[model samples]
Target chain A: MNFPSKLIEDAVNEISRLPGIGKKTALRLALHLLKQKESVSESLSQAILKMRTEVKYCAVCHNISDAEICGICASNKRDRSIICVVEEIPDVLAIENTAQYNGLYHVLGGVISPMHGVGPDELKIASLMKRIEEADAGVKEVILALPATMEGDTTSFYVTRLLSARGVKVSTIARGIPIGGELEYTDEVTLGRSILTRVNYSAE
Target chain B: MNFPSKLIEDAVNEISRLPGIGKKTALRLALHLLKQKESVSESLSQAILKMRTEVKYCAVCHNISDAEICGICASNKRDRSIICVVEEIPDVLAIENTAQYNGLYHVLGGVISPMHGVGPDELKIASLMKRIEEADAGVKEVILALPATMEGDTTSFYVTRLLSARGVKVSTIARGIPIGGELEYTDEVTLGRSILTRVNYSAE
Candidate 1:
């Protein structure tokens, strides 16, 4: 599609490079930006540039941060004896949003997907092992909170095998029907897994 | 949702401010940007900023342009006798894409909508009249190609009334069922209009 201005064409092209955004949507977004206050565009541009160039990953957990170590790793309130491993930064955010986990996080950056050319060496597996095996780290438990996919399971199994050799305790989050999920609509594998891992009922 | 870092949160907030984008989508975009090369974010940010700050409106037609006069208006090949009036800049691009019209265009910027606090004065209506009334301009015919909405109709009627007083020929694009549209699924209003405006079929 032709744009009335070169600047608009350039903007639309760059915007459409992003995932899920097409040329039409990019054009619409560019037009909307044109109609808004200059400060709006200024802030948006500045924020994106600053985030891309300056954002740091925590030295210990590999989570996004502004300093050497992330807030979760730095906070004394968090359980340093436990580290929940995940695939990406968004996973850390999702688990944090639940407010149910008080342990630290170790972002693997990505799972071991041979199809995608991502191997164990491409992730933070070595850094994770280093943190857990530290003589003074006192890491008692390592939780695998990854995706419910073949790649996630493969990564988990690999990590579990390595951790078990080092005499470190490893656990996984339960896979079952989600909270408020109807049993009728639940997949058979998940339903069967839920039944196999059933816990004693407690009214209190 | 909570962000791992202030920078990520700021970037997400700015991105979410765009139309049709929510916090979750914004987060996804921010994360995607983080994973991409720094050059990608730099180009996206720079393009948006440049487009917003530097884009110009044509002096005569009011379409988005890089110079005071748009390329269409500056060109000698385009017919100056007729003008196709549209509601916004994108409409000009849409018509240009069709390659059916070779005449110049007058972008109204928007239609009259009292509910949105947009009056005739808010658009380029006055500039359009100025261009048409110019003695040496030699503009003879004006085509109303606004939207099919009430505000579009109101603007069209108002422009036609004004142009008629000056003895200028005014016409409107036909409204009917679209090309390749199935008759069975056509809406009642459009099907009725298509039948009413049916023209004699010409083999030549």
Candidate 2:
């Protein structure tokens, strides 16, 4: 309402559309951008643009990447025998920051939230199963690092049942992470501890 | 170390550069962008790019605009005779949000801060003085709407001395605003009250 400029107003509005960024915070961020040198703002804008234009989902692991395979999937140092499954790319970053895990990762895109209309058909579960069954026989484990939500638990159970049918070692990352704690907020020490304490999941 | 893609890493790193956005939060925002439809991220990115590319400062009032003069300076409905000086464009927005003030504004760009090496020359003080001294004779009241910080007080005193010597009615928004409070953070009611009870400067 009667903002300083149309461009600024539009910019603030667009930023406010971002999750967790309100109008007041958007205004503060926009003003901060306006105050910086033109090059800084220009670079920031370009980086955001590049993220949309260049990044894509790694076809193999469903992780975000600029190519067919994500860096984690491409890395020779990581143990291909173990694949840590998570709900999103940020979960990959959370695990990576720990500097303790030397295993590969697979992003599930999302958990099975029937309430949100998300089912196995919409997820990358089929591809995950195929990858595990088809990988060279060195594959030893498939770790479910999904959030400890009900939906995450349901998805993990279904995956374990399916993967176990193929005789692959199935495990869920430890429940040491708080029941409601988001992977994005957990610190490296706690996350590493949880990873180290992974538990086995067997079909009842 | 082994971030998925250069573009994704660059975007996350750029976002992390913002105040209070840590590496984890940056990664979270980047992942959110990746999750959105391509068009949504592209549009938001383009909006930021356009803001940096097309937005410019109003030569007359120092507020950001797409043209040479800001809307407040060009609007015939606004009282150009009364110039309300503020530290930033957000301050102008704060005042305008009330819809009670009819006066135009002058943005100082920043207040005087010795610790930050910001002084009179760093701000738009000279341009403001030129507008007052050489503009139409209708120009009368010059209200200082600066923050209540030590730097804000110093800047106000400095600007008041400069304008007072030129035989103009120089005033400052009252001290009702809590000390050390920023204009951007104050409520409209408090700011309006401060404006209504502005104190006139006199020779000691």
lDDT of each: 0.93, 0.84
Q: Which stretches of candidate 1 lie over 4 Å from their true place?
A: A135-137, A202-204, B135-137, B202-204
Across A69-137, the per-residue lDDT of candidate 1 in tens digits comes to 989999989888999999998899899999999999999999999999999999999999999878376
Task: Write down the worst ten-residue block by lDDT for model 2 chain B.
Answer: B195-204
Q: Pairing residues by index, what is the TM-score of model 1?
A: 0.96
In candidate 2, stretches whose alpha carbon ends up further than 4 angstroms from where it belongs are A177-204, B177-204
Top DockQ: which candidate number?
1
**B11-105, model 1: which lDDT tens digit per residue?**
99999999999999999999899999999999999999999999998999999999999999989999999999999888999999998999999
TM-score of each: 0.96, 0.82
Judge the docking of candidate 2 as incorrect, acceptable, medium or high: medium
